[model samples]
Every structure is written in structure tokens, then in C-alpha cells.
Target: MSEVRLYSKADFSECRLTNHPLYSYIQVFFSQELSELVENSTNGTCYALEVGQKLCLVVVAQFQEGQTYPTSLRAQYLDYAQEELALTGIKGKRLLSGAFQLLKRIVPKTIDEVVYVGNYLLSTNLFQPFTTEELQKIEALLQRRFPTKTIVYRSQNSCLNQQLMENLSALNYQSFISRQVFIAHQSQVIQQKKTFKKDRKLAKDTTFNIRTNFDVTNYSERIIELYTQLYISKYSQINPRYTPAFIEAMKTVQNTSFTGVFDEENLIGVTMSWELDGTLTVPILGYDLSYPKESGIYRLLTYYTLLRVNDEQLFHMSSGVGPFKLSRGAEYFPEYIYYKRPASAKERRLSFWLLQKVNTILTRMSNKRAY
Candidate 1:
């Protein structure tokens, strides 16, 4: 029952939950590229408290620069807020809290680089614990220290910190995840083990194929195309998400392990994955929108997860609102989007102002863009 403190990244390996399956899950979810961004930008002053040998309390933060955003003159802000406000209080709270926490941590240091910060956590098997008030207190401590910076605390309907959103708002702080949707596995991923095994065989038997290795030759364009199709089918009606440059960057990350299923030479499905710190993450996957029967893409990808599951890692499927994954037996891992900061006055002043400006600009921005 001893709580081992992780005050530095060097202490990561020794921390108990670092060895857990779910720990690997969150690591994999952010992917190596995203993780490295956090890694390269992080200030090791970050800390965590490990409970027993399973659950961990992690705090990730970075100091960075200003971000460049394209101006949207034709964009309308009214309709956007109307819809955003139309969402239930539960959802609005989850998104804002998560984003706010990240902003709060990195605000003071982000004088030069546009950085996103907060706690990225891994809860040990069956022993996760953290309350909403605890998270807000962390945010308050940051605000007390740095009053001018614009910091946001963000999270979504996280079961672990259910009371967070209301508590933060009650304190007069605004929160948002902005443009994001979250989906979790409702059932267990193990039940689909049989189906996953069968799909791999099906992919191999016919021209319908799947690969364990990442061959980045003609693949970049393929990655771009399929991802674009996914955007068109899934998100185009509502919002324009994933720019061409962002899609192109997917092919450049290291330790990338991607699996693709083909329908007689046509790349029907592709899952862009990465393995790191013993975790595997699928941040992007796409298939023919019309191929409903082949939704087995997820099942096959889970089957592909067998490659690393035995290596003591949890396959992180990343964030999405998709519900189909719940039926596949992937366990739901609840986590909070905590708002915390370093103790300092210069930091506090800078943080408060930054949050206000960004929130104002974002609030004024429209949801839909022609470009």
C-alpha cells in the first residue's frame, strides 16, 4: 500500500503501473509522434503518485511558443456557440475541463512555442482513484500563482472524475475540449478474439490482405487517400477535420506499426499504429464507408494487437466517439483531465491572460470552414 512518488521521468520505469497493461494503453493512444511532442517539450518537474502497484497519478506539462492560426473572416461564431451550448452540460464540461487542464500546465512556459499540456495518466488494474475537487484544487493553485496566462482545464465524461466539470465552473473558470468526441469500449475486447483470428485468415485467403509491418513507400498517398475518405464519410457533413499536412505527417513517425486490409488490391482499410514504452496505439483507421460488413477492420486490428499484447502492453485505440468498439471487448479505462500548474507569480499572471485571449478568439471562430 506504499505510494511511490514519480517526481522525474527517470523514475518512470520503477513506478509500478509502468508495468501494467492499461499503462501501455494510454501511451499507445497518443502515438509516438504525439508522445514525443510531449516528451521533447516536457519540464521534468512533472510529478505523479503511484498507488500500490497498479494505478498512477501522472502530470505532463511543457513550455512552448505561440501558435499560428489562419484567419476566418467569413466564419460565423453565433451558430457555432448555439450548437456548442446546445450540448448537454455533461459533454460541455468534459471537453472544457480536459482542454483547460492542459492549457493551465503549459501556459506560463509556452511563451515561445505553442504547447498543449496536462496530465496524461494510466490507472492500474482495478485501483484507480482521483476526485474532481482534487483536480480543481490543482488548477486553483496554478491560477493563484500565474494570473495573466490563459490556461484551460479539459476532460470529457470521465467516470473517474465525474464531479470535475461542475466543480470547476462553480469556481468561475470556463472549460472546453472544443472540437473533440470520445468513445469507449462498452464490452470486452477478448470476446472478439475468435472473430479477430477469423478476419486475419479472411484477409490473407483472398486479395483481402493485412500486414504487420509498416512499408512506407507508396503508402503515404494511400494513407492520405483513405484517411481523406474517412473524413469525407464520417466528418465532412459536420466539420472539416484533419488537414492534408496532418495526414501526410502520419507516414513520417518512427516505430510506426501500421496494418492495412485490402479488397483485391484496393486498400479498403488501414490502421496507422505506433509502439512505444511497450504500448501500441491506433490513432487513425479508415475503410470504404460503404463496406459496412467489413467493419471487421477494428476486429482485425485488435487481432493484430496480439503481436504486442503478449509483450506486456495494452493496445491504445486512441480517442473517438465511435460505439462499435465497445462491443469488441476492449475495456473502458476512465481518467480525468486535471488542471494543475507550477507555483509561481510570473507564471500565474501570464497563464490567466493567455487563457482569456485564446478562449475569446476560439469562441469567436466558426465551426465550419470552406478551406
Candidate 2:
């Protein structure tokens, strides 16, 4: 049996697991450079955990004691209440606002100190297999190190992470569907979805050029600007407020590929993606909201992504635009957040339990309405 060694930003460079199979993952995700970037952009503090020599996990500690909702987990998990209620008209808006206020008073306060295992601040989390004994050791170590903080493991549907989710469940972690993610099999989409065919045609006819040969370091600022325009300014400030430094840092990350959508000399769209186990996930994507909708830049970007997914690969499109994705033959599945609190932390545990029940009811209602 090997020991679980934890590394904080202060001593992360001292981690001696150089010969680990996933050493490249450590360089990209757990490096000091990326840790600084994440801490600067979000409310979480990043850490690394080495479980013997076989596994290395990215750990994020979110201490949102006095943080605003935009920078906290509350925004990611519960802010959808506002969007969902808007569909119900004025009365629903008012009622939901009041209910949200009540929840804000109770929910966010209880989740102040949380430790997220394997959180990369992305919509989807990928996992590597380890024995139940390894998981137990990791859990015990986290519990001992942060006794009062709740522990969370976030991952996609059971289809992708069944064994890991089951392991967490057996360890008494309560699971909740955080959001629904969309997945499209490339060959299926190309062959069966007419909308995909139309999108591909539109991409082919469009004047904008999708370039993968540009230097990421040189376009870092523009990438951040375009990303902020769509993800933060237009959508929600709750999205990670990534800076140019983060974009520039991508030059050192070997796994991720960045592509730019250009209209002649102007860059109008950007996407960052990585593939693992024949599954491609685009974690960073943004387009110029100011561009004319008729220009079909967004469509071109999506088409380009689909082209990357060959017959052997599946594309995980994260969450949002349910109807658009579904129309293009994408299947939907629930992404989950699994959590556990210390037995001595009664109040926090009770709060999370109540939250879990509420989330379960809401998810069921949403599913019923969707179908």
C-alpha cells in the first residue's frame, strides 16, 4: 500500500512522482502556472494529491465564506432558477426571485468550505480507474486534512463514469445531478442528422476561415477577450473569468488544441478542446456576439468540432442549447456532483441533505417537463 501525499501551491514543485504514467497530465493540470491561473480566475485554491505512484488527482478547495454568488458554486448549481422561471412569465419571476432569496440565505452559507476532488473547472470530468482501497485511502486522507469541509466528486453520466460514481456511492456520498450534458457520436450525427448536414454545408459555404495553425501565445489576449464577451458578458459572469495569462499558458499544455474562426483578418471565434479515451470535450469556446447572426460563425465552429470527432470518437458538448443539440442528433445525460460531509458537522450535513432533496425533486420535474 502506498501513502496519499498532498501538495499545496507552496510545495507543489517538490512532488516526486516523475515516472507516473500521467506525468503530462500533472504538467498541464497540476502545474504551478495553471494553479496560479485558476486561483486568479476563480474563487478556488488548487492543490494536487498523489496516491502512491499510480494516480494523481487535481483538488480544488473553494472557501466562499464571503465570496459573491458569481464566483461561488451557488451560481453554477442554483442560478438556473432565474433562467427557468423566466419562461413562466411575470408572476413566476417574482415568486422564483423570492424563493431564490430564501435559498440564498440558507444554501450558500452552508457550503462555505468545500474540497472538490478531480475538479478541473470544466463542464466534464474524466476519471482513471483505481481500486476501492485506493479510493478509501484518498477519502480518509481528505477527511483528516480538511475535517470541516465537505468533499465533492464531480463527473458526467454513469455511461462514462459508472465505476467511480458507484465507488463514491458505496462510501456514503450523496449524488445529485448538477446539469444535463449533450453528447453526439460523430458518425451517427454525420449520417443521421439532417441539421448536421445543413450545418456542414453552411460551414463549407461560409467565408470565414477556421484556422488551427495560428500561434496561441500571440492570440492570447484576443482569445480571452472573445471568450469574456460571450461567456461572461453575454451569458453569465458566473463563468470562469479567465485572463490572458490563462490563454497564454495553454502553449505549454500539450493535450489541448486551440482553433480560431477568422473572417479574413479578424478573429471572431475561438475553441479549446482536448480528447481522452476517444471522447472529445470542448471546455473553452467563445464567439463574437457582435457578429451578425446570419454570418453563421457559431455554426461553422460547431461543424469544425464535429469534423474532429471521427468514427471512433464521441463528442461531449457540455451543457446548454438543449434543443439545438438534440436537433443535431445529440443525446442528453445528467452530469452529477457527489458529496459527503463529516458526521460531526451536523448543520452542514443537514443543509446538504435538504439541498439534495430539493435538487432531486427539481430534476425530476425538469425531466418530466422535457419529455
Candidate 3:
């Protein structure tokens, strides 16, 4: 087995290479310069397995402690919990909170720690081809490296690595379905949906200028304000929080581009996307929620994205709306967060059992509602 070594903040530069064609996105994040840019947020540690000086496998993990969950994960959990409680009366809310307390009892408070492998916000992880034995060896190394904390790997857009998945399963990693990502590809063949048609009609009447580059620093304050209004106040359960500092940092990221939707001098909407390897990944979309839905900004943006796809002849386009993507002739993949802990860890074992029990109850309730 190849030796696996841990690299500190200073040694991440060793992993940076010219290009691997298939893994440019992975390469960009693993580079020392980019890693330093994100260090304040990610707090990551890099690891690599080498075979005779050749890098065979690499893993980057973020260390998180109590109340130190990433801004995105904490926001999603709190928002979703609050949204669910809103439907119930005071008594129901109390009961649900009690249920959460019971769950917390099963999990050790000291172990609310996790090491997230991959892009903590976007759920993308990369690994070079390695044998099953090598994968197992890497897993063991991770366990030894972080003996007290749980390890999590998030896979999104159905980009699953067979070898890594198998190795994780062999090590008894438990999986939980998170959400879905919507991807539109080869969209020139897609038939326009009702939303598309409605937006086309509205676009003729509404005049908004779309530009690829606008002064991010000048509008940085307003951009964060609008983003909070739309994301936090409105769609509260969404993952990822775009603070002014984070957005400003993202503007400097090499692969990303910023697009502004303007009504004369006023900025109405904005999107930040990455164009990588024939794929366009839109990570942020902030807009004026006061605008009437009939104004068709949502559909107009979708239309604009597909237009770019057709013009560039790109292979993939990813949007945040999962259900609407299907209507736009796109495929949706359910995302998952996989977790692993030492087999002897009591908290992990009990939590897994509780999860299975809760899943069964939820399934029964869903089936009854359907009938």
C-alpha cells in the first residue's frame, strides 16, 4: 500500500499541478493560492497518498467543532426546523422540540464535531483512480487522523465515484439523502415549457440590461442586502449564506463569472457562476423578491442560461431549482451526505438506529397521506 501523508497549510502547494484535463475543477480548489483564499472559511487540512513520488489520491477536509458548523449547514438546519414548526400550534412546536431534544440525547454533545471532506458548501469531492485496497488504506488513515470526530463526504449532481463509494460502504459509512440538484444539458433539444413561453412573452415588454461584468465592490453592500432579503428572509431553508466578504472573495476566484441584471441604473438581480470543463455551475442567484412573479425574472434567467448553453454548445448547465428543472427538460439527481464513525462509538451507533426508526415512521405517515 502507498503511504498516506498529511499536509499542513504550508504543503498544499505540492498537490497543485499543470492540468489533469478531467479534474480541473478539483485542481483549482486544491491549489495553494485558492486554498489560502478560502482558509478563513474552510479551515481545511489536505492529505495525499503517493506511489513512488506520484500523487495517487488526495483528500481535503474541513474541521468543524460545536456551534462551528459551516454557515450554510447551520442556516439550513435552523430554517428547515423552523419552517416545519410553523405549521403546528404552540403545543405542536413544543412537542417537536421535545422530539429534537430526545434525538440530542442519543447523540453525544461532545461529538457534535465533524470533518467535512470536499467543498463544504457545494458538496463536490474528487479522487483519482485507486484500487479498492488503496481506498481502504486511505479510509483507515482518515480514521486514525481524526479519531474523535465524525467524517462526512457529500456527493452532489450524482457524480459518484464507484471505487470510493464501495470503500466507504466497506468501512460501514451511513448515508442520508440531502436534496437534489437540477442539471440541464444538450438543451437545444429541449422543448420550451409553459414558464419559458410565459417568460418569453413578458421579456418583450420588460426591459432589463444583462451584463457580464459590473463593479462588484461598488455594489457589494447592496448585493449582500438583497441576498439576505431573498435567501434568509424568504427562502430560509436554502444551503449557503452569501456574506459580503464571501461574495467579494468569490469574485476573485479564477473560474467564476458575475452577471448582473439591471433596470437602467438599478441592479435588480445577480448571478455568480463557474464555467468549468464544458459545464456551467451557478452557485449564487440573488434578486429583488418584490418584483411580481409575472415580471418573469426567474424564467428569463433560465432562458438566458439556456441561450448561453446553446451558443457555447456546452454539455451541462446546473440550476438551483430542482423541480422546475424537470419542467425545463433537465435531469435531477438526489444529493446525499455520507457519514462514518468508529464502530465502537456509542453515539454514532445509537443515532443510526434512531435514524432508521424515524425513517420508518416518516415513510408510514407519507404512505397514509397518499392513500
Candidate 4:
């Protein structure tokens, strides 16, 4: 059996290359810079198993050491830190998060502590193939590792929709966070829904032409401009992820990517995403609402994304944060979070307190009112 070996940096860089799926990891997200970053990374460890020398899964802690370093890393520094870390894979839900897991084996307070941590924004295909049953199995594994009344799984992008939430609830995972996802699924009766007829009168006024995967220069500023406009508008429940600067920096990212509806001379709306590693991630969307009735652009964008990308292993349209998705025909799936405990009681207590602080900081970070 080929062991899933943890290759060091020299090995990672020196390995002879081939036309492997792993090479996909090196593209936009896991650039040489990001790969090299793993060396001095205190927050996390990166691991990969050579799959026939062509495929190497992008694996690492979506986080760094904050007393949560893996047992391996902790053992190396145990005399000084007395920490433990363990790795896990995505049992269900988000791609990057569920793909693999990592944690400190030791906890504070009691041996009762448990941790099943998931991080959003990993490579799109990290969960290459996933299922709900496998997720339940992960929960079962945590049960054997650590017993607990509480588990926490956090998600961004608001991609998990209501039906999925119901399924999870049937399985005992409830929505404890404000984040949400939207879906638009087509069914037998609804399959015959009326066609969206373009108003010829408004068509003349609408000059926006939609395109895929273009350089940010043509529409970067304008896209961000619409985002800023949205920031001022009250429609968006939370528009706290991107700053104009971050949006600008994204352009430098390879596969400078997004789907946009441009109005002749102006950029009317754009749905910006990143092809990180091999996964597609939704960072944000900015649309000119001035043409809600006339634009019909968001609808068009969704249709094309489904028509083109849906066949290639189904794209994650994200959570039900927008009403538009429900009308368009997207299906929602449940995303979950699980937490298992450390063997040590002392570490469990420490983990609890640290988690409290971390959640607070994260919540505030997402709240633009304070920004």
C-alpha cells in the first residue's frame, strides 16, 4: 500500500513533474510562492501524497498554530509549548475544509473536549468526491476521539441552502450562524417555466455584454465601483469580505477570473471569483441594480454558469444570501461543522477559551458596521 507520505519542501519542489492533476494545484492558488510559504508556516503544515506521480492533493491546515499545532509539530516543540495536532479530511460539506483535518491532540479543562474544525476557501476539488454518509462517519470518528455536547463548523460564501440545512438538522447539525445559501432547482412542472423575454425597448438601453474569464484591467475598477455602490445600498445583508484594495490585489492572481455584464462604456455588474488551486470560489458580486427590471443580467449570468460549468462536476453557486438564486433554479446542500476534544483536560479548557476569542474576532471582522 502506498503510504500518504508528508513530503518536505526540497522533495515537494524537486519532484519531477508530469501532466498530473496535482499540477492543477500549482496554478492560480498554490503558486510557487504559496508552496514555499509552507516552509516557515507556523499557522499550519502542508502535506501531499504522490498519486502515481501526477496528482498531489493540496493539503494543509487552513489555520496556523495558536496552541492548536498538530501533535507532530507540538512534539517537536512540546518542551516549550506542550501542544498536539492531528489531521483530518473533509467528511462532508465545503471542498477545502472537509478534504483534510488537523488539530492539537491535547486540550484544556477536561479530556471531554472535542474538535472537528473546517475551513472555507480551500481548493475547489479538495473534496474531489464527497457524500453525506461519509460526513456522518466523520462525526462517528470524532465521537470515538472526544465526547462532547457541542461541535463547531464555520463556513463562508453562505453556500449551504435550506433543504440541505433540513437534511443536516435531520442528522442533528443545526444552523447556529448567520451565514446562509440560496438555491434554484428546476423540477418537472417548473421545467416549463416561462421564458425570460427581453424587452426590446429596454434592450436598446442595455448595452452590457457578458463575458467569461477576462483580465481585471478591463473591468476591475468598475466591478469594485459597483461593489462600493452596493456597500452604500441597504440590500446587501453583509458586504464585508472585500475591500477595494483586496479586489485590486485579486487581479494579480493568475486566471484573473470573473463573469461580468458590461453596459457598453461602463461595467454594470460582475460576479468575481477565483480559481484557487483547482477549486472555484465566490469572493463577491457587484451588480448595477439601476436596471433590475431592464438588466435581467443576474439571471443571464446564473443561466450561463449552470449551462457551461454545471456539467463539469457541478459548480458551487454559494449559499442562499440572495433571493435571485431561488427563482433561477439552484439546489441547496447542507454544510456542517464538527468539533472533537483533546485527550487532556487542561488543553480542552484552553481550546474552549481560545475558540471564544477567535469567534468574537471573526464575527467582528465580518461586520462592516464597525468597519
The alpha-carbon deviation from the true structure for residue 136 of candidate 1, after best TM-score superposition, in angstroms, is 16
Q: What lDDT tens digits, residue by residue, belong to model 4 across residues 1-371? A: 22223344446664454444444344322344332322222333333434323233332333333322121122222211111111212122133221212223333223212242332222111232223554455456445533442333333223433343444456666442222233333333123344323222233455667677566765656776676575435333122323444455556555336777776656677776644333444555767777775456666655545443332223455543333554445544433332333333244455445444433433443342110
What value does the lDDT take at residue 364 in candidate 4? 46
Clash-forming residue pairs, model 3? none
Say which candidate scores most in TM-score.
2
Alpha-carbon lDDT, every model = 0.43, 0.69, 0.54, 0.40
Compared with the true structure, the alpha-carbon lDDT of candidate 2 equals 0.69
Residue lDDT tens for model 1, 234-300 = 5432222333344444454455556777766677677766554454556556666667754565556
TM-score of every candidate: 0.45, 0.87, 0.71, 0.49
Model 2: number of clashes? 0
Model 4: how far is 246 from its true place, Å? 7.9
| Ten-residue stretch with the least lDDT total in model 2 | 63-72
Q: Give the TM-score of candidate 3.
A: 0.71
Worst 10 residues of 4 by lDDT: 79-88
Candidate 1, lDDT over the whole model: 0.43
